[model samples]
Target: MVPAIESVGIGRLATCLREAGLLLLLALSVTVAAWLIRPEKMSLRAETAFYELELDAPLIAVADALVLYDTGSHLFLDTRTAGPGSFVTIPGALPVRVTTFDDDLYENRDFLYPEDPVVLFGDGNLPAVSDVAALLLERGFEEIMIMGGDLEAWRRTGGPLADHQAGEHE
Candidate 1:
């Protein structure tokens, strides 16, 4: 009887171990597939990849932008000053209004940190984003990125848009 009981316990233990091993392998396989099929490589320009997110554009170093804003050191601007202009924005995204963009960035140089990430956004495939990136580079902004997709993608993703047009305080 003792031997029979011992054999049953061993069988159960072996079954549990097999199940655990299978689960681990399955998880590992899924992780590897996710890594391999990840979307287009991160681009530094506004021209590459299908426009998807404004609040979290892959083309933009969104992580850096968060760092800058969290520390009160950086500015996110809608670069769609030409054509029809931007229609939405990432939630809580502060405007680099024409007045400030002109005076603050150009004349006053407010919040100037060469290392800070300056993110510029605009409409799909617009040139303004790249222009801002270049200008910031010239201004010694060590990190600059253009959100590949403009405000449309932002709005579609339920990203917060400023209430400027609605007369609500941003």
Candidate 2:
């Protein structure tokens, strides 16, 4: 009876080990197959223009931005996402969502003329603004500048803010 029980236990252990080995082998085979079938080359520009934009767009200090705003010589594009509550934006800044940049550009084509000097600003890090700047460059916007600081910086510098409530006439 001891010998019979030993034999059963050994058989179950062997079966479990064999199944585990097969599963591991299957996973390895699938991984190798996927690796081999993956594309060998991709266009970096086509895939991510923003990466290039980071290298190209010039950074503008808050003081310079204030000067530009006062002169009204350049268009101010705010790339921040609208948050809950009344929208507070920089005076004369056009709200631009990076996700809908192309549509927004088309809708505001008159203001976003290709030749105009455009200044982009958003949260301090400038991720959304950078992306929008890249898209603008791709669309033939020649002069794009990224504001050095964010909304807080603008506030700190005494930049004017306007309440942009929906349904209210500007």
Candidate 3:
């Protein structure tokens, strides 16, 4: 009789478990259906527009950069990390911190001309230069040039350094 009662309890437990599982499955299916039919969806056109933005910036030798620098019309953007180490940037160049790129760009938007040449340089940070160049291109900057040399090269090429050093690198 005890065994018979135990089997009956086990059957009830199995039925509860099966029903619970079915309920959970139903809930999950409803959640997924709602997500699939959500009103707001990501726009593929925006992604395509972003892909269409030209990310390849032309390279400009240090010598050519020097010439453009002398013209005083071209905008020189220093995208090097600010702080420490013997990093010297071109005098009068706009300092754009790689970490705060968007804010720096917005702050200096008045100085930016979409049609003017924008020279970008960094202290052996090629990615930073390329990223900044891409952002400039996205902002409608026509001529974005990544300086082919490092800050030391710029310093050697008679490119005057700013009066204050950025800081020291650790």
Candidate 4:
């Protein structure tokens, strides 16, 4: 009777070990299959298929813009018109009003370069934003990006902002 009980216990342990081994094998197989079928290449540009803007420039997220801002590798341009209202902008951003793009470009040409990265954003000024992007493209800028949302969006995304007197950019 004792031998019969020991045999039964050994049988249950072997069955449990077999099941656990099979489960581990199944998990490994799934992991390998997923890795084998993963996309060969990933696109860096943000998906803009759902966006309303039809401009040729690529749109970058505020988080990514923040990364660029941190690296200090990109020149940020503020495209909003300066007026009586209080103005806030990303730190180190230069004012380049679309209405005075030519003069602004001339004034800032030394800072503007075709090879360097440039990021443009506006305060609910989508049209002016596109205009600024186009103007920059025409001047042979190779890497011009537009921030996806307005200045308020930037503020909400933990981006640092600096205040300027009204019409100071004008």
Candidate 5:
């Protein structure tokens, strides 16, 4: 009787070990297959060159942006997020958030045109502005500009600010 009980215990241990080994092997196989089947459209060198160009892109001063605004030949994109009760933006400026920018927004005639000059500005946040500009460049926007200053500079230059929340009033 004692021998039979010992044999049963050993049999259960062996079965558990075999199951665990098979599971590990299956997981490893899946991982390797996924790696081998991954897409390869964007190469490392191409990605690096894109970032280099984005970093070295030309910057437009607040003065120049204002002039363009007055001329009505350029479109202004305000990438600033509203804080508390304040959502001030340049007059006629379209609001754009980097994280939420959609391709469909560009399809709207009122929002974007590929050939039109576009000035992208944030609340003095370089990284945020650069990210949005990079996305625009990737989407093949012809002429893109980054504002050299922040919202304060826009106000200092007497650039009109309209409350973003004020729909018809704007």
Candidate 6:
């Protein structure tokens, strides 16, 4: 009654092709919609530095603490991105680059030497700051203080900050 059929499922093959086309169209539609309505970035006014951290305790006020070491007291550290914060720092702090840098900053023979309190700083917050403090502690430093509030707090309060117009390169 029926003509000789060369393929068993010619009709089914056509239906499958139609379904595949529909699925492709749906996927493309979703992709386009997602691109048109993407989420926005954060607007919070915040800054960042070499690391992110939460200090275990508050550091003694830079002004009244006399953080600056005379010979074997304490060491001021500015752990911000180097070459930029040359001037920006705590009132009585000094700059120290801790970017796996192999220079005098990492050396143990500097004037401050070992067994001194080293105050570390960051832009918004320094990452692995506790580890750095621990390293300094292992090196005989008595106390390692991690400064809070970061560069934003320091600049907003008009602390010892540099005025140079650091460009995007920084």
Q: Whose TM-score is greatest here? A: 4
Computed on alpha carbons, the lDDT of every model, listed in order, comes to 0.54, 0.76, 0.73, 0.78, 0.71, 0.53
Candidate number that wins on lDDT, 2 or 6: 2
Give candidate 5's error at residue 111 in angstroms. 2.8
lDDT of 6 by residue, 1-170 (tens): 87787565989898889999999999999977776664422224554442243554345433323324334355666556556433544454544445642353444344456666576666644454554555556657666777654666555444555443222112
Which pairs clash inside model 1?
Answer: 91-160, 122-150
lDDT of 1 by residue, 23-119 (tens): 9999999977776775533444654245543422235544444445467554566555433334445544444433245453543244445676556
Better of 2 and 5 by TM-score: 2
Q: List the residue pairs that clash in candidate 4.
A: none
TM-score of 6: 0.45
Cα displacement (Å) at residue 39, model 2: 55
The TM-scores, one per candidate, come to 0.47, 0.62, 0.58, 0.65, 0.59, 0.45
Q: Order of all candidates by TM-score, from best down to worst? A: 4, 2, 5, 3, 1, 6
The better-scoring model by lDDT among 1 and 5 is 5
Tens digits of per-residue lDDT, candidate 3, 81-119, equal 676644445776776766877877777767766887888
lDDT for position 66 in model 2: 84
Candidate 5 on 17-133: residue-level lDDT in tens? 999999999999997777677542223354443345444246787877888888888888876655445477887777666766673344345657777788988887667787877
Q: Where does candidate 5 have its weakest 10-residue lDDT segment?
A: 40-49
Q: Which is the better candidate, 2 or 4, if ranked by lDDT?
A: 4
In candidate 1 the C-alpha lDDT for residue 156 amounts to 50
Against the hidden true structure, what lDDT does model 5 obtain? 0.71
Clashing residue pairs in candidate 3 are 84-167, 84-168, 84-169, 85-168, 85-169
Residue runs of model 1 more than 4 Å from their true location after superposition:
1-58, 61-74, 82-113, 165-170
Q: In model 4, which range of ten residues has the least summed lDDT?
A: 38-47
Tens-digit lDDT track for model 2 on 1-170? 35654455888999989999999999999987877775432223453433344544888878789889999899888888776567888876776668777766766766668899989998876666778888889889899999977877787777888887532223
After superposing candidate 3, which stretches have Cα over 4 Å from the reference? Answer: 1-55, 84-87, 165-170
